[model samples]
Target: MALSLVHFPSEVWNHIFQYLSAADKFSVRASCRYFRKLIDHWSLWKNWTIVLSFKNGPYNSEFWDSLRRRKVSSVVMRNTKTKDWSRLSLALPTLTTVIMDQNSNGNLNFIQDFSHLNRLAIRSSAVLLDLHTQTQLQHLTHLSMCNVLFPNKSNWSFLNLLPFLSSLTSVVCHNTNSFGQRDRMVDTLVSILPKLKHLSLSAKYISPQRDGSIFKPVTSLSSLELIDCLDHSSPEDVGQMISGLKCLRVFFKHSHQGRPEALSASVIYLKTWLSESAQLSNLTVVKGPPVRMYATSIPATITNLTLCVSGLSPRDMAAVAQQVPDLLHLHIDAWPSHLGAHTARIPELFPKLRSLKLRQDHVPEKDFLRLQQLQDLECLEILDRGHWSDLYKKLQTLTRNRLRVVTSSPQRDAFHCPCVSQVY
Candidate 1:
C-alpha cells in the first residue's frame, strides 16, 4: 500500500510542496536530483516571503542573491541586526513590499535605492531614517508603523516628511510615538497627502482641544480607525470629532479599557452622533469587555457590526438584537465556557444576520455544532487560535458546505472576511 512519489508528475509534486515550510522544501530538495531540480524551478520561488532573523546566524548573502535572481517580491525581516541590512538590500533590489518586525537600530543606507518598493511596514522598533531618504521613497504608496518610536537625533519630523510623498495613499500608525508634535502631525497629514483615502492612528495622539486651526475636517478620507485612543472621560468630545467626517464610510474604534461608565456614556453619545451621519456604513469595535453598550438605537445606515469582547452573556446578545435589528452581518467574540448551554439560543437573537463570526481560543464541539439552528446564517467564520483544526473538520462535516466556511488568521481575522460585503 506504499505510494510511489516518483510516479507523480512534477505539477502534482509542486502542488504538494506548496504546503511545506521553506526549511522543509530545502530538506526535500536534498533527498534526490529530481527533487532538487523541482525545487529549483523558478516558478515555485519567484514570489517568496522569506523571514530573516539574526538568531539563525548571519544571513547567507549568496542564497539571497539566488532569490533575487529568481525575482522574489515580498520579504518579512524579523529581529534583524544593523549589519545584515546592507546585504539584504543588495540581495533584493526588486522587492515591492517589506515588513520589518523588531529590527534593531535601522538606518536609511539599506533602503536608499529600492526604486520598486511600494509598501513598507515597521513594528515594535525605534528606527530612524533621514529626511533625504524619506523624500527619495516617492514610490511608496502604503506605510504602516505600529508601536514604533522615532529617534530624536534624526532631526526628521513625520509631520514634515509625510507632505512630500505624493504617491502615498494609505497610512496606519498604531501606538506610534512622534517626539513632541503629535497634534501637528495629524492635522497636516490630510493636506500633505492629497491621495490619502484610508488612515488609522492611535486616538491619544489626536489633540483633545477643538482648535479650528488644528482639527480641520478631512472630507476626502473614506475610512478611519482610532485604536485605544478615545478619551474615556469625554464622550462628547469624541462625538464632536466623529461629527465632522461627513464623507466617512468605515469607522473602527478599539477601546483599551471598558470601564462601564465611560463605555456606556460613549455608546450613548455615539448613538446620537451616528444617527445623524448618513454616510457611515460599517462599524467595528476591536475590544469591548462588557459586550453590551447601552445605545439608544443603532444607526439605520449601519449594516455591518463586528465586536471583539472578552466575554458575552445572554443579556449582551439581547441588547445587540434590540439595538441593531437591521444588521446584516454580526461578528462577536464567543467563549465556549461563556456560552455553556446558551449557544443555540443566542443564534435566534440576530434574526437578520446572514453572516456570523465566532472568535475563540477553544470550542466545545457540541456547543459549536449547535450553530446549525441558525437558519439565516449563509456564512460562518471560525476565527480561533491553535485549536481550530479539529473544529474546522467537524464544522465542515456537519454543515456540508451549506454555510460558507471562511478562514483567516486568528489575530483579528473576523475583520478581514472578504465574503462580507462591507469590511474595515
Candidate 2:
C-alpha cells in the first residue's frame, strides 16, 4: 500500500506543512492542486525575506509577482544592489515594514516611493537623501539606519533633514560618524522630533560632556538604548545625559569594552538620578563590571534585570543582587570561575525571579542544581556549544520532573530544547 498525504484532513495537512522546510513545502504545492491551494494561504505569506546580490544574481521577478496576492507585511532584501529600489517595493502594496542593504554611496531614491511605510531599516552603508525624498517619509514611525553620514560632514545639515520626518516616533542611529560635529545629537533629536518616544544611539557618537542648555528635561521619551563603541565618557557624564528622560521607563545599555568601574560608577550615578528625576522600570546592562558593589544600590523599580559581567566576585554579586527584590526576570553572564560561589546564593538573590538565563562559560553541575532550586522559575535557558553529556543528562531529568530545561547550541536564535543535540 502507498502512503498518501491527501488522505489527511486540511487541518492535519496544514499542521504537517508547518513542520516542513520551505523547499519541501513548495514540493508539496507542486504535487497536487488541493495542496497548491492550501500552501498559498495568506497566513504563510504574511512575513517573508528575500536575499539576492544585485551585483551577482538576476532579479527574481517571479518571486515578487507571487507576493502580490499574499498579505506580506514585512520583507527583507539582503545584499541589495543600487538599482531601482522603488520598483522592488512597488510590487508589495501591503508591505508596512521594509529592511534593505544598499551598496556603498547608494542614493536613497527607493525609500521615497514607500508611501505606506511605517518602519524602515537601512542595515548596510550610509544613506544621503535629498530634502524632497525626505518629505515622502512623513508616515514613517520607526527608522533604523547604519553608519549614517551626510555630505560636507556638517551635523546641522543632518539635523535639518530629521524635522521633515515629523511622524517618526522611534529612531535608531547605529555606527554614526564620531566626528566632533555631533556632540549634541541627542538634544537635536529631542528638539526636532516632539513625538519621539523611543531612541537608540551608539555611545561613541555622543560626547561625554553635558550640554545643559541643549539637553534639558524631555518628558516625551519612554525608552532609551545606548550601544557602546569605545566610549571615553565618565559615569557622571553618562548619568547627566540620561537624567533628563523624566518619563523614561526602559533603559538598556551595552558597553562592549566592559569597563566595570566606569559602568558601575555610571549605574551608581544613574540610580541617584532615577530617584531624583525619572524612574526606570526595566534595566539591562551588558559587559558590566562590579566596581561599586559596596557602594552602588540597584533601584527597586527595576523588575526585569540583565547583567552581563566579567570577573564577578561573590561579595559584588551579593551586593548587586540585594538591590532588586522585585526582579522577575534575570539574565547573568559571567566567567565560570566566579560563578561557583554564587550558585547557592541564586535563590536568595532573586526570590521572585521567574525566568533565568545563564550563559555557558564553565558552569558547574552544582550551579545548575541550585538554579533548579528556584521554585518560581518558569523558564531556564543554558546557551553555548560544547560537549556536556553530563549536563545534558541532568537537564533531561528536569523534563521528566516537569521542569523543562531549554538548551541551545551555538546559533544565536536557536530554540530551546531538552534534547537540542538530537534535534539539531
Candidate 3:
C-alpha cells in the first residue's frame, strides 16, 4: 500500500510521464532530479520530430530498404567518425518539427536555431543556408525543403538568405532537384515571404534549368500545391510555366507519368492556370485522373475542396459534384470503374459533403451502405486496408448500433499506450 509522491497529482504525474517509450522518453529524462522536472515540457518537445539516418547501399528498392530500417530513437550516426552535425543533443531548442537524413548532409546549422518556427521539413541534401548568422528564425512559418545536390561552385540564394523572414506564410518545395539558381530560387521566394500564403511545388523537374520567370512572385498566393516529379513536362507545360498566381487556392497531386497525364496536361491548359490564380479557393488533387474534369468551372468564390479520385470520370465526378456550393472536404480513392456503379450514385455525387474520407479498397459493400444516405455527413472515415471486420459488422447493422468497437491493435515493440487508464 505505497504509491504516493505526495498523493500523485501533477496532472497524475503528467499522465504517468506520457506513457514513456521514445526510448522511455529519453530514459525518463535520465531518471530523477524529480523526473527531470516533470519531463521537461516545452510542450514536451512541441510536435517534435527528429528522424536520424545513415547510408551507403547496394540495395535495389524494397521501397529504399524499408526506408532504411526506421526506428530512430534519438541521435544516431552510422559510418561515423563524427565530422560535425553541429553539436547534436538532438539540437533541441524546443524544436518545432524537423526530420533529418535524406542521406545526412546535415548543416542548415541546426535550422538556424529555431525560435518558434512553425514547421520546416527537410530531406535530401543542401539548398544553401548561411544567412550570415540567422537571427532566431523570426517566427518562421511552415517551410519544407528537399533540394538534392546543386553545388556546382555555389553562390547561395535559397530564397536570398531569407530576406527578413517576415513571418513567412507557407512554402514547400519538395525534392527540388537542383532547386536554386533558378530565378535565384523562385525570385527570392516571391520577393521575401511577405505573408505569402501556402505553396507546394514538388519536384518540378528539379532544375535542369528553368526560368519560368520566377512565377512572377506569385502575388501573395492563397494556396498552391503542384507536384511535377519529372513525368517529363506537360501539365500544359507546367501550366504555361508557373502561371503567375493571384491568390490561388490549391491545385495539385500532379504526378502523371503519361497515360493521359491530365490529357497531355491540359484541362483547357489548366483553365489558363486557373484563370491566372485570382481569388482561387481549394483544390487538392493527387493526379491519376483529371484530363478533362475541369474545363471551365471551379471558381464561384472558389469554395472549399479536395480530390484524388484516382483518374476521374464517373460522368466527370458527377458533374463536379454538381457544382460545389461550399463543399467542405471530400477525399475519395478507388476508381476502378467506381465499382458497382458508384453505389447508386451517392446522392448524385457529393451534394455538399461536410467531411468524407472513403479510401483505398475502393468503396464497395454497396457503396459503403450508400454511406448511410448522407444527409450532410458530419464526419465519416471508412478507411480500409484489409480486415475491417466485415465492414465493422456492417457498421453495426448500419449506423452505430453498437459494434462495441473500442479496439486496440498495439504492436509497437509490443505494448505501452493502450490506456484509458490501461483498460478494465
Candidate 4:
C-alpha cells in the first residue's frame, strides 16, 4: 500500500510546493481543484517573484489577471522592448521592486507609474529616464546600476536624479561612465544622501586624494567597496580613508594589476592602517600577495581575513600566526606548488580559527587530514582543481563527523561558504 501525494497533509504539500517554480505551480493547479485552491492561497504568493520576459512576446490579459490575483510584489524584466507599461501599473498595483536587464530599447518612464517601488536594478541595459517628471520614488531605499546606460542629455543622467531619492540607503554603480567629476560626485552624494550606509563604486571614478570634508558628512557609511580602483592611489591616501570612517567595519579592495612595486608599497600602507583603524575587523585583498610581508603590522583586531595570492609559504604562515592571533575566519587561494609543507602547520598556526577555506590545485591527503587538529573548526571548504573523494571520506572519519567538508572545482564551481555571511 503506497501512499499517494493527496494523502499527505496540506502542510506537507505547501512545504513541497514552496520549492516549485511559478510555472510548476500553475501546472499543479490545472491538474486538480484541491491543488488550485492551495495555489490560490495568498500566503503562497507572498514571497513569489513574477518574471516578465518581454522577448517571449507580450503576455495575455489572463497572465496579468493571475498576477493581480496573486498580488505579486516583485518582477524581473528581461530583453524588454518598448511597450506600454501602463498595463503593468494597473495589473500589479502592489509592485515594489523592478529589475531590468538586457534591455536596449526600453524607457524607465514606467517607473513613475509605480509609486510604491522601493528597489530598482538596471544591468546591461540602455534606458531613457524622464528627468522632467515631478513624480519621485520617495520609498526607494536601494538602487543598483551595472553596465547601464542613460541618454547623453545633461539632465537625463542618473546622477542628476539621485538627489531626489532621499530615502536611499544603499547605492551600487559600476562600469557606467557618465560621472564627470568623480571627486565632487562622491562629496555631493554623501552631502545629500545623509542616510546612505553602503556604497560600492569603481575606484577609477574617485580621486585618490583623501578629502577631509567627504568623511565628515558620511558618518552613516559602514560598508564601502572600491573595485579595481587601487592602481593609482597611494598607501597614505587609502590609510586616511580608513581612519576617517569611524563606523567602517568592512573594507574590501580588488586590484587587477599585480605589480610587485605596488604590492610592496601596499604592505607598508596596510601595516599603518591596520594599526590605526580600530573599527576594521574584516579585510580582504584579492589578486595580490599575502600581507605576510608586513605580518607584524597586522592588528589582532582583524578576525576575518582573505588573501587571494599566487602562493603562501610556511614562513608566511608563521608570521601570520605570530601577529593575528585572534583570527577566527581565514580564506586563502594559493598555488599548490608554492604552498610546500604549509598545510600541516595550519592547525598549529591558527588554533583559534573557526572556519577555513583553501583554494589549491593539489593537496596531499595526509596534509589535508592535519586540519582536523583544529578542534574549534566547524566548516572546511576546499576549491581544488582535482577531486579527492578518498581524502574527503578520510577527513570526515578523522573529525568524527563533526566537521563539514565542502569541495568543488576551482575553475567551474562557485565557492560558497556558510562562514562567510557578509556580502562583500
Candidate 5:
C-alpha cells in the first residue's frame, strides 16, 4: 500500500505547513480539504501581515471574517480614504499593529477603536488626531510618525498628547515640517513620559530654550538619536542636555547641515560627558572633523564606537586605541590621506577588537593582511573594494576560517554574518 499525505496525522501536516511559503501553502490547500484545514491554522498566520487598500471601498464582510478567523494581528493601510473604521474595529478586534501610509483623507480617531494595538506608524500622510480619542489608546507602546502633518494644531502640538498614552515605551518623529518650539516640545515629553525608553527625532535644528536653559534629563530613556538636528548651540548646552540623562546607554548624533565650528564644539562637550558616563557603552558621531582633539576623553566603558567624519587620521586612531583599550567594535568612515599607512598597526592598537569596519580608507592588501593578527577578530567589513583580491579567503585561512569578510556595500552583503551588532 502506498502512503499518502492524508495518512499522516494533522499534527504532522501542520508541522509540514510551517515550512511552505504562503503561495505554496495556498497551492497545496487547493489540492485537498485536509491540507486546506491544516493551512488555515492560526499558527501559520501568526507572523503574516495583511496589506489592505481602502482606495476603492471597504472590504466585504466575508473578507473581514476571513481575517478574523485567521487571527490576523497586523495590517498596513495604503491609499486609505475610509471613514467606516467602526466596522473594521468590530471585525478584527485582534489587531495589535497598524501602519497607515500614503493616506490623505483618514483621521487618526480610528486608532481608538483598536483596543489591543501595541504599535502604530504613520508615514507620508496628513491626518487629524482627535485629542479626546487619543487618550483611549492605552495599549499603544510604540508610536512613529514621518513626514506627517496635523493641519489643525500648532507646530508639534501632537507631542503634547503623548503623556496620555502611559504605556508608550518608544517614539520616533522624523521629516516633519512643524518643528517650531522644539526645546519646549522635547522638554515636555521627557518630563511627562516616565515610561519612555527610546526616543529619536529629526529636525532642522536643536537648541536650548530661548531662555538659555538646556533640555531636562529623563531617567527612563536609555537610547537617544538626533538626526540632522544640531546647530549654533553652545557645547555647554549640548553637554548639559546629554550629561543630565543618567540612564543613557546609547547615543547617536548625525548632522548634514551643522556648521564645522558648532559640530566641533559639540564633540568637545561629548568628550566631557563620555569621560564621566559610566553607563554609556555605545556612541556614534557623524559629520564632525575634530575627533582626534577629543579622542582621549573616551572612557574604557565604551565598547562600541563609530566615527563618520573627514578628519580621522592615523594619529587619531592611535589616540582612540589608547583611550578605549577594551573597545570591542570600531567603525571609521573617513578618507584621510594617510590612514592606510597606519593600517598595519591596528592589531597592536586594538588587540581585543572583535569587529572592524572601514570605509574609503584604501588600505593596501599587505596592510590589510596584518589584521589577521587579531586573535579575537570575528568580522571585517570594507566599503571600498579597490585594493584587495581574494582577501576574504586569505583572511579565512589566516584565522582558521573563524573570521567573516564582507566587501563592497554593507547593505548588499549584510546577511553574510551579523552586520555591525547593535550596542543594545
Candidate 6:
C-alpha cells in the first residue's frame, strides 16, 4: 500500500528532513503552516552559514536576511562582500561563527551587539570592540580569525583580545605579508590567548626576547604550530620553545619572508626535541626538505605522521619506510616531484605501513603497484581535478583487491577547503 506523508511519525519525518539543505529545509517549511510549526520546533535551522556578497546580487545579505526571518542563530560567511558585512540586519546575535572574507573590499566595521554569541570568525581588518576578543561568550570553543589588522589604538592590543575568549580552545589565524609590523603583531599574540589546546599561528621574526616580560609563554598550550615561521627565531631558541610544551603538535613550513635554510634548521632541532620530549607521542614534520635529515629524529613512540612533499620520491618514501615503525596512519598529497626521476625507482619499500591515503593534485592516475604492497589500505579517494574519464578502470582495480570503499568529488570551485572553512 502507498503510504501518505501525513501518516509518518515526526521522528521519522525529521530523519528525512535532516538531509535537506537549509534553503531546501526552509522551502519545505514554507509549503504550509504545519511545516512552519514543525520546522520551528527543530534546531537545524537555528545555526546558519551563509556567504555574504557586497555586490548586492540575488544571493546576498538581503537574501540571507530573508532567511534570517526564519530564525538562524549562527552564520559563517566565506568570500563575502564588504557591503554585506556592513549591512547586517543585527537579528543574528545568536550566531556563533561569523566569517566575512574574500577578495571583496569595504571599510571594516565594529559589532555592538551579539549578547548571546559564543564563538566568532572575522576575515577583515575591522578591530573588534572586544568586551574581552571574547567575554560572555560562554559556549564559544573554536575561533578562526584571518586578515585582521591592528587599528593603532592604545586600547586594542593582542593580549586584550584574549581575556574575552576565556572559553576558546581552537584557533587558526593568518596574517598577510603586508600586514602590521611582524614582531609587534606576534608579540601581541604570544602574550595573549592564555589557554589553548590547538593553535595555528604564522608570523615573521618572532625571536624570544631577553626580557621575559616582553614575551610570556602560555604554559597551558598543548598543540602548537609556527607555520610559515618567517625568520622568527634562531634554530636553538626554537628548539627551546618546543621543549616547553608538555604536550604538542608542531608544524613548520617554508615561507616567502625567510630563508628556506633557516626553516630547515628549525625543523632539525624540532625533530630532536620531539625525540627527547617525554609524554609527547604525536609528531608530524613536512615541507622543509628530505625526510632523511629528520625522519630518524622523530620519537620512536610517535603514532601519527603526515608528509606534504611534492611526490613519493625515493628519498622521501625511503625515509618514511625505514624510520617510522609505530606509526598508525599516513596521508600523502602525491604529486610528481620529477616525472620519471625518483618515485618510479622505489615501488616496493613501504611494506610495513598500515593505512595509506594517496591524494592527487588533478590527474587520476594510480600508482597501482604501490597499492598492492601496502599491508593495509583503509581510506582511498579518487579526487578528480575536473571529471573522471576512467572511473571503471579505477573501480575495477579497487574491487579486485577487496579494499574498503573510497570517496570522491570532481573539480569544482566551491569544494571543501580546510583552510578557509576553519580559518574564521
**Which candidate number would show the highest TM-score if scored against the true structure?**
2
Residue-level lDDT tens digits of model 1 in 278-328: 566676654443545533344556678776554667877777677666778
Candidate 2: where are CA atoms >4 Å away?
Answer: 1-4, 16-40, 44-48, 65-70, 79-84, 153-156, 178-182, 208-215, 229-231, 234-278, 291-295, 335-341, 385-404, 409-424
**True lDDT of residue 54, candidate 2:** 53
- From the highest TM-score down, the ranking of the candidates is 2, 1, 4, 5, 6, 3
Candidate 4 residue lDDT tens string, 1-424: 2358677888888888886666788899898867877777666787666667755566788878667767778887777655636657777766887877678846777777788888887778876666553255556798777787776653566666777878888777777765764454455576778798767666556564455543333355666555553535433444444443332222224432446656665566556656666666676655444546667766667788776555566776788788778889988766434464478788998998888888534556677788889999988887553477777778889889888877742221111111122322
Could you tell which candidate, 1 or 3, scores higher by lDDT?
A: 1
Clashing pairs in 5: none
- The lDDT of model 5 is 0.66
RMSD, every candidate, angstroms: 5.3, 5.9, 17.5, 5.4, 6.4, 6.4
TM-score of 4: 0.76
Whole-model alpha-carbon lDDT for candidate 3: 0.49
- Model 4 spans > 4 angstroms off: 4-6, 13-52, 59-75, 82-96, 132-134, 182-186, 210-217, 233-235, 244-258, 264-276, 335-341, 384-390, 407-424
CA shift at 21, candidate 1, in angstroms? 6.6
TM-scores for all candidates: the values are 0.76, 0.78, 0.29, 0.76, 0.71, 0.66
Give me candidate 5's TM-score against the actual structure. 0.71
**Cα miss at 242, model 1 (Å)?**
5.3
Q: lDDT per residue, candidate 6, 357-398, as tens digits? A: 544333224544345445464544433232443553464475
Best by lDDT: 5
Comparing 1 and 2 by lDDT, which wins? Answer: 1
Q: How many clashing pairs does model 4 include?
A: 0
Model 6 spans > 4 angstroms off: 1-48, 54-73, 77-91, 102-112, 128-140, 176-194, 209-219, 231-235, 243-269, 276-286, 334-355, 360-376, 383-424
* 346: Cα error in model 4, Å: 2.4
Each candidate's lDDT (Cα)?
0.62, 0.60, 0.49, 0.65, 0.66, 0.50
Candidate 6 lDDT at 409 equals: 38
Ten contiguous residues with the weakest lDDT in model 6: 415-424
Reference-based lDDT, residue 266, model 4? 58
Superposed by TM-score, candidate 1 places the C-alpha of residue 409 at a distance from the truth, in angstroms, of: 4.3
